[model samples]
Target: MIIDGHSYCFPPLGEANGFPTVQEHLRYLQREMADHHQPVWRLRDWAVGDNSLLAEPQDKTLQGLKEVNFRSGGYGRFVWTVEGEEYAKQYLPPYLTDLSHPPEMLIAQMDYIGIDRAVLHAHPIFGFLNDYLADCVQRYPNRLFALASIPEWKIEHDSQGIVNEIQRAYSKGLNGLQFSVHNRYRYSVTESWDAPACRPFWDGVTALGKPIFFTICAPCPGSTVEDYLSQLRIWQGWLTRYPNVSAVLTHGFPWRLFLSDHGLHLPDALFEPFRTSSAKLQLLFQISLGNVWDYPYTQLHPTIVQLVETLGSDRLMWGTDMPNVERFCNYRQNLETFRTHCQGVISDQDINNIIGGTAAQLFNLGDSQ
Candidate 1:
């Protein structure tokens, strides 16, 4: 069966934002800006309101940037506003204004794209969505599976709370965990999960016996290949220690970070983590480098061949970032990039595993039917 290995579902703007509070959310976003060099800003000159890619580009007032607010432009857009003037904005799907990207919305997109099932991810920007996602999965048991989110920042301080939430979310039928390595910055000193303090969190995850979907990338823009390689080493160490824990590298490897005028320069050392039996990688190029490359992404075909040859076809799974990727290409196009475009570079047999066979086996979707 065809399955989207990655996607997101959340509530409406009012219900979604204001996790701990608007001020804290702003601080977290600021930390993200400082920690990572977001390349999407380069997509369009945010100055002078040039969000032409959006269906309805709104006015951008950058002069008086005072506070960030949600529910702007009728509740679908996240805007940087001060006294009612929007300075900058992040546009979500317009349909989200009704009540966020519910299961129905994603299922409709999946059906239109001819996807049989999908796995959902919980994003911090959308606040904690374990309960919401549990309901979504409950509503569409055969069609969806979701991961639980934890406040990584609190793990060092509130380890019990973090573990409790994991157990609770798991008992409620949430499938696995979505752990963002970058979110650890919310805590003053950033450390890898292998750190002593994070032991309990990992132990809890181990007890549940579910896979972890990881968002691992360079911590900042100025980070070198070694810096990225260091993160992979940490992952390799974790997999070595917890041999039973299945791990998935969300969005695949950071190909964009390694790409330059010299073209994609991925070092052989980078694929070491996937050498672990329990590790898998998600190929969602459409969301990560869609702005930098076009549909069919012929440029990535060679990389795909290399990954298959090096990591083995069974270690790779296909995923679409879903609704968020709409700005770059529609849902159908996202699937076709791997399914149809990379035909010769990737054998039809390997393509079958990359698209659906692997995901179904990894996520245990076979029994869901």
Candidate 2:
């Protein structure tokens, strides 16, 4: 069974909600303001991946503002829309943030891609609304696992402690939590992974007995590589500070891709501590794949071969960051890169670990490990 560590579904516009079309979202926003009787779910409140994205593009003028977009600075590059109209049209494909992609749509895609299951989360920078994610997973219990998102906004705003929010999400049957050290967009708010203010939040997750995963990407625009490395160190401190916590480090594919072309090593300062602590703590690495074939030619990036050699296949895992990757090719073709590239470098057992076995062991899927 292939388990994709990173995959998402921002259901196609819900016809009931008039989604994909802005009328439904506007209606909800209007009603939310008029009646505050009970808690109202505004589209942007928890609809992380697509709310603002869907609305603004519809505005004839704001479409021109894509030029002013700011992603997190450090190592995050600045993107100027040199090619205007052409870029806007290709910026985000309609299906990715579509209004109709429901659980069934995902199941069909899974079957076509030969993926048996996936670890799920909301879109980057948007807060984690596991309720919607949980519903999707529940409908396809055999195929999806929902990871609760840390409400970065709430934690920053509400002094009541995020423990309650974390507890509530876990009580609802969400499996784990996902946060990133590297903030995706300039407007995205993220608390430090090792902040003292987060003790209560961390303790709450500790109680749930589930692991936390950190998804990382290199070349953060404003920050230096050291800033990115500092984030890794912060996570390492967590592994040392919290003995029971298991963490997954992801999107190492960018680093891998960069290294293969540049001939630089994945700085030992960052990789060594995690490697040494594996026996004493739960720290694993995950390799992410998206539509990189457009630039780096995407066939397993040789970095995985080096990583498997150093960390061992059991310590490394694989993920296909889907929906976003569909722009490259269909899902099955994505996995084909892995199958063909590993030819004789590592044993089949090693390949199994990267594909699904390691996650089964880490997430504790019975008998599958």
lDDT of each: 0.72, 0.52
TM-score of 1: 0.86
**What TM-score, computed on C-alpha atoms, does each candidate reach?**
0.86, 0.70
In model 2, which regions exceed 4 Å deviation?
12-100, 124-127, 153-161, 183-193, 217-222, 256-264, 279-301
The per-prediction CA RMSD against the true structure, in angstroms, equals 5.4, 10.2
Name the TM-score of candidate 2: 0.70
Enumerate clash totals for all models, in the order shown.
0, 21
lDDT of 1 by residue, 173-253 (tens): 899999987666445446775698888778777878888888886654456788889998998988888888888899888
Worst 10 residues of 1 by lDDT: 55-64
